[model samples]
Target: MIDETDESLNKSSLVFGNFAVLVVFVLLVGGVYLWVSKKNKTGQQVFPAGVNYLSPKGDEAKKPVLLYDFAKLAESSDWVTYKGKIYPFSFQYPKVLTPLTFPNDRSDAVTFKVNELSPEQSLLFTVETISSRDKNLVGKPEEFAKNYWKFFSGLKALNKITKITNEKGMTGYQATYVVKGKNAITSDNYFFVVEGDDEILLHIGDIFPTEGKAVLNRLVNSLEYKK
Candidate 1:
């Protein structure tokens, strides 16, 4: 025979068990909502789209070493290459100098101006190919500079015409000369190069001031004859 008291206690136990389960379900739903709301408020993407934020990793990943820093890399060297169209030679210039530009006449000469100079500025570097058309034309360095007022007129030789070997082992002639401009400001240095069929003249002026001697030397030293 079943007791009435026992049956009543069994019914109360069943109701309490169901109520406990309902309370747990409500708490779980509320926790998930709170988590999503917090993430949205913070504007944080815990993981990429379609990725499970709850995924686990065995260990933390190592930070990658950055290989590129444009500003710093630019400091290493601002070299720009220029290939000769008439001759088989190549040279480089720094950011302070402009790239070589051929005039509309496309004569034997190519000119590179100072980056900071105006059109009226007198400071510039030039390379001229001794046109093969003139078999009598000598490939000597001074042949290109004799008529150039800055290289010949009032020229005080700073150093003897010396043999210079570029990085590529192409031997050339180099001589530094002192010349004064119309403004009466004396340029302490002028550099010249004479190779196979080409001659280069670098006229020192306000663009390459007295304080930039080392930089100017480095730029000149980078010249190379591709041939």
Candidate 2:
């Protein structure tokens, strides 16, 4: 009877050990499956599946280039003289000029007038060549800046200056200002005051409309100085 009892006890212990081993194997496999599933869901690793890496061929990636010709325009204008360097003023829309008159103080200075289509545009382009003596009398750039502020107190009041950049490409001191008031709008006015040179070129204008930007870009792109 004692021998039978011992054999039964040994069989029961072996069965429990085998059952525990099977449970541990199952738990390990389940843990690995969960880890892999979580990794895939979180996109931590790329799947071994194939991917299409090439960009589509139909789309042209190049930007359209703009071109302009100022010489051709200068030839057509009677008001413009070929003896001096020519500045181009070409636009998509027809521009009508208003009568221009010289200021009482600056009799030699010439001013050309035009009507701005909207409040957001400039209505005139003033170009003047100052003599060396006049430039010296007025003082250099620093003095001119001080005098400019004194004369145009509105400029100081509004303080719409966005940037004052040294535009070496255009060869001058470029001070950009945002216009104010009901008709006042944001526009670009380029002032080119060449150092030691008395001649100052002022290009005051508004940006072309979205539809006209392409043509305007071409016009500006064509700009060149006759040296």
Candidate 3:
């Protein structure tokens, strides 16, 4: 009789350890697969299937190489005008995109999305009201944009500020910045700063990258202020 009870205990312990190890191995494989699915080489990061976790990121974060053409937009007929209800301005967006007004009001801004898919998400469109009294924006939208970005949290770096003009021939400033995180990337998401009257400034950020920077260029250039 070679210690039968002790042998049984050792056998049970070995079985449990092996089971635990198997479970851990499975979990590790699943986690790696998920991460690889999320991040891509071209910088396109895909969000998991769900509305709660969906937000703009990845390839759209890269600073766009500026190659703006306004004529194509002029020739295109697939756009619809989104007039501001609270502000004295209007812009055009592609008909393929659906616009959702936040708070059920256009008083703030509008979010446009082709779908719930990530890496290529909504275009964050908003015409913000900034104080016109700020001396930074007195005559220079560029300065206003530069000064505005200073307070942007997690600002990792700033791209060269470029002078941009809209289709209406109104002047604005385009600026790009990188935020420090996997979710917020650097490059290509363009922010346009337009000087309002002596009491207001309009800030628009084109966040839709799936459709290409040309679409963003069209949207920015289509902006026209009635006031």
Model 1 Cα shift for residue 36 (angstroms): 89
lDDT of each: 0.43, 0.34, 0.55
Tell me how candidate 1 scores on lDDT. 0.43
Stretches of candidate 2 off by over 4 Å are 1-124, 129-169, 178-185, 207-222
**What is the C-alpha lDDT profile of model 1 across 1-227, one tens digit per residue?**
99999999999999999999999999999999999998876633221111111112254322223223323323457677766565444556555455544455232233344233333333334344344323333455554333233323344324334555556555545433333221122332233454443434332222343333455455556655554
| Candidate topping TM-score | 3
How would you encode candidate 3's per-residue C-alpha lDDT over 6-98 as one tens digit per residue?
Answer: 999999999999999999999999999888877754354332111112134655443333232334544568899887767777889777556
> Which runs in model 1 stand beyond 4 Å of their true positions?
1-75, 95-102, 105-123, 129-160, 178-207
Q: List the residue pairs that clash in candidate 1.
A: none
Clash counts per candidate, in order, are 0, 0, 6
Minimum summed lDDT over a 10-residue window in model 2 is located at: 47-56
* True-vs-predicted CA distance for residue 15, candidate 3, Å: 53
Worst 10 residues of 3 by lDDT: 46-55
Per-residue lDDT over 1-227 for candidate 2, one digit per residue giving the tens place of the 0 to 100 score: 47998999999999999999999999999999999998877633221000001111255222222122323323334332211123332222222222333345231222222222322122323343333325652425433322232232123222233323331233333232322222222233333444444454433233333233333333333323333
Measured by lDDT, the strongest candidate is: 3
